[model samples]
Target: MATISEQNASSISPVIRLHRSDDVVIARSQLVGGTVLQEEGVTVSGLVPPGHKIAVRAIGQGQPVRRYGQIIGFASRPIAPGEHVHTHNLAMGEFQRDYAFCADAKPTRVADGNATFDGIVRPDGRVATRNYIGILTSVNCSATVARAIADRFRRDIHPEALGAYPNIDGVVALTHGVGCAVDAEGEALEILQRTLGGYVVHPNFAAVLVIGLGCETNQIARLVEKQHLEALVSTGRLSTYNIQETGGTVKSIERGVELVQGLLAKANDARREPVPASHLVVGLQCGGSDGYSGISANPALGAAVDLLVAHGGTAILSETPEIYGAEHLLTRRALNAQVAEKLVARIRWWEDYCARNHASLDNNPSAGNKAGGLTTILEKSLGAVAKGGTTNLVDVYEYAQPVHAKGFVFMDTPGYDPISATGQVAGGANLICFTTGRGSAYGCAPTPSLKIATNEALWQRQQDDMDLNCGPILAGTKTIEEVGAELFQLMLQVASGQRSRSEIHGYGQNEFVPWQIGAIT
Candidate 1:
């Protein structure tokens, strides 16, 4: 894909052609009927919304439509040049994907020197971007009690609550709606336990508390045993209590408060020290995306990921469902056949999972995404994969599994934003870099989230929620590399304690959603 500047250099083009062979071009702005696309040598046949597609050439019914030099979908009907092409004319179709493993894998270009950040170093040599006391629940029944305990220490509600513990970020309670109805030996239980375990040992948390209902199937003891959290419990860094065992909700809340208070001093003992950028682990995500997502923010973020990997840091690209048709892109860049096969296996699993549920992978480009000019899953997937950057896929992981490999990697996760990001955080991402063109308001606790706007209009409309703007790339004022370098610096600053817009608004606490699988009964 040509940079926006290069595409618009001669004269400001009203539409953007991602590839010379693309059947459609994205409207740079609203183009009224009869408007002339001088460069494409076509006159607009009808009104086209900003960021929407306009056919660049004639296409026959059942013919594949290309974008980004890849097939996005097939033309459902004959499409005339200059005509608007969207769901009404474009549809999903089956096609063969060439999974030539390691075909494009290349050695990483290491940066000259390591970048540094002011980070909190744990006694065990782990690094943290923020310090907080986390309260986790094993079942829905203990949610209220956990919230009550965290409410008492709300800095916004009571400014003086943490007067003495300046180092502590804040107290947060991460609760879920399911736990009791799940099978004790099922995948759902295992996922929940793994997610909870990740939080207990997350470096951002100085200490953690687990609350549970004594009679629930998701027993606290089993969770501890399964996740191997006994070490944290033994060291007093993790504490667990049951509402039923504690006698009632009131007693549970009181005990929880007391436990948190006792840990404040120890949590406050954490002090910031200089740490290498190699310690940074970022989770890559994009939500409420639009046409400019691939054109601007996604690729720009990918560039930043390349820079991060060059510095020996790690970046995790997840949302397996969102990357449905794009898996082959990552597979070819895999470090070896084993890594490539792992990614392909996940894709196959999703295919069967969707088939069992009577669903299709094409059931994406949600209403919001369609409204933003995305037409099919293939189109969206092509854009989504751009956030991973051009790098060899070092490893692949199941949902919520710990990420031990450094450099760009993939994780199997659903398309839902909250659940997908939840898995990423559980996999040891200390920070999140999220790209959005439709202005999604999201955050992940324990791990700070940085929002990047994909277009100028969104940046202007949602400036308060956005941390950085890649809009300049869309406006032809900046290149992807330029914005990417800027984003990399911002990552270091945020990792060093500079609060993102979402953090300032306290958006993380309510966004904890673990991926739920298996039967409720």
Candidate 2:
């Protein structure tokens, strides 16, 4: 009788060939002292450390390095057949290239017929997946008052579906780290102002009340002057107030709560009505990832993102640092080669950025990531890009800028989740979808966030925080496609007024971190 193949059927058969013409394999697990890998009836190589690569053939300098069927890097030196290939001999190719914007983002004509989610219709003609009353602080001095106002509501009342406003969600107070002691004309001021302005005008918010101490540099009046919002809430009109103009904290809190209550009454009149899927903007992000992240959550999320795009919605893939190694895959799919080149340029910029700061892009895969089995940033990045799916690269955006592209687009941001999600939120993401392999307690203000867990143990351990468990893929229970679709469904529910664990626990707002890029001096 033929011997049963000893290769464990449930274990991920190591992808030994990424390109048909290539011959290198990544180690799936740590090898015993003298393990040998056999491929195509030939001994390809001996045991290699997990996450390291070994060649079955020779490569020369300038030759492309392939992984996951994509160009991950290039050979920096000559290598004999069957030699180990890694950082010592490979590096990202730095090149100059032209960028084309919107050239390849050919206005996609979305499929006219598609299912619509029940959503909150905004007076701005923008369909919103959420209906929230936002209490915004213009400066840190107002942070306490803002939180106090929210507390009054959360502690005092359980929302009863108000007539005509059955869709109204609870109150949220958004406070942040900045808004004090910054240059008035610098990028920080502009970003801080725009972010505040953007949230005030956000479709997800039905009512917004500004709270501030008045003298702070991030003046509410300037925000009013800039956005021409003297006529605030022109559509389904509601109360707009500022605390500084009020006598003091006690009066401001009382007045803010009254205004919030009235707005809640008005917002409660709204009911979820059917709207096209295109109204949804999902922010795709990955953090606390491991070796299995790319193989599981990221790709699974990518598949879900593609499905959302197919249904005529939007998906934003962010975190500039995380995109480092796999930018080539994104470049090829660039709406145009120029858009492709733009992405390539960003990748190149990050290289010098890290080098100058005396840091290494590979310095990531933090202690947590390493403990969870990730070996390098390249390994992490290759997994992170899987969340964007196989969609054509449609557009690239700078930090926190508006994204009007209909399909998948890239947003520039640091790998830090708070700041990254903050930018994505300002860029018009209605909902943030985050995947974590080692489990992260991440949240986004104004916009709702749904967390997808990478491993089952982590999911079960943190069931109160995790919204979706992707560990089934590792447990021989489910496929990436199925879990992905399930996640998409959960996203729709959250968009349509279902409270995620984060929302229920009020875990957002505190996480808003703008990418601060200057010296304090």
Candidate 3:
């Protein structure tokens, strides 16, 4: 904590620093224009942005500056205590890293064996968070056919003939890029097949129908051979038909509708029962962030993330740009140096990636973010990282790639909400936990998503969209731990098939925007 006069308790440093050689203090509240506060026994000299740092102690040349109990960076020159710390005095420097053997993590076995949620268990040794029959398109050529089949089978509109299917969530068309242009055996094509393959076995799915255009590169046969998707076909849990093989769009849609109706019959037989909380993987993301986000909603969500982790569950944090200046915080908590190295390497790649593309990572604090009092990418990043909680970063992954780590894993992705959410879903995340200060009424695909508001005002204002309120942290009413426990409880309900407001209003079907990386010809 930074030193301050007794006359002003409000002038205290924001974070609990673990290192004695630290020269900076995290801002607890928004430090806006013209507001001066004394820190570390120094007179007011310069203004410090919220989520940014102010020097708390003096450091000589070539000294290590610590935050989160590790070297985030080093000093540029001699600096006195209580000076503002920004890009001028700090820079990103490379250091030798040890990428040693990374084995299975030993999270202590939770003694609360009774901590189970009512979930629909499947025969595949996996538990379901929701019960939905999915219509997945193998190629863009079959997208319309898949959608048409869904339209004809929706119980709400066509309740006359679909007598066997009961309470069925309407069909979702999972379509994407790279099914046609890529080489048949390429890595990109292989990744797409596995992602779709994973979804067929997803516990949330009760039944699956694969719709394809036979002429396309991504044939369903490869999915079986490459990903061993034959189990789905053998158990009568999945069926595949192609438009070119059938005839035309009209004939394919008719065939798809009949096949989906049969799958729906098998899916409706499932019922919810007690299941462990460890099956739940909450995907934490935020978009349209503002200054209030770090101080209110993000940290509150962080507390919720901690509860889930403590319960032997998993929480994933994504959106690369959102974590720009705050990547160092996560690095120190990395269980081993390899996980930390993987995270930093991704950051380095993004820096070079931006430079090559003529884009700046800092050019993101959108008009909405600026209006909400966020001044820089540095300030927003510090706040945005709060959603990951205090857990060690166990693993890291690329865009739209499967998340291999348990507890807390970082996936590299752009800050766009819809695309980022898409990558998370493809990475095997079943539930998305989103926090917003400016109040985005957002939702994702077939996977259930929970919206949390950063403050009380946003929660009340957008009562219909928000599922939980971290506003008490802003109002000094509820501690983060209290709100976090409640969030974990709500996750179980969501996993058990309880509907969020956005889901009730049909939010999942259209949010699928795959990350289109590399050059498009």
TM-score of each: 0.98, 0.82, 0.80
Best-fitting candidate, measured by lDDT? 1
- CA RMSD of all predictions: 1.2, 5.5, 5.4
lDDT (Cα, tens digit) per residue for candidate 3, span 90-135: 5444444333333323443343544567777778676667777888
Q: Which ranges of candidate 2 are over 4 A from the true structure?
A: 1-66, 69-113, 155-166, 233-244, 344-360, 475-477, 519-521
Off by over 4 Å in 1: 1-11
Steric clash count of candidate 1: 0
**Candidate 3 clashing pairs, residues 3+ apart or interchain:** 23-56, 297-454
Per-residue CA lDDT of model 2 for 211-254, tens digit only, reads: 77878787877877775666775543434455658888899989
The per-model lDDT (C-alpha) reads 0.91, 0.72, 0.71
Model 1 lowest lDDT segment of ten: 2-11
lDDT of 3 at 116: 66
lDDT of 2: 0.72
**Candidate numbers sorted by TM-score from highest down:** 1, 2, 3
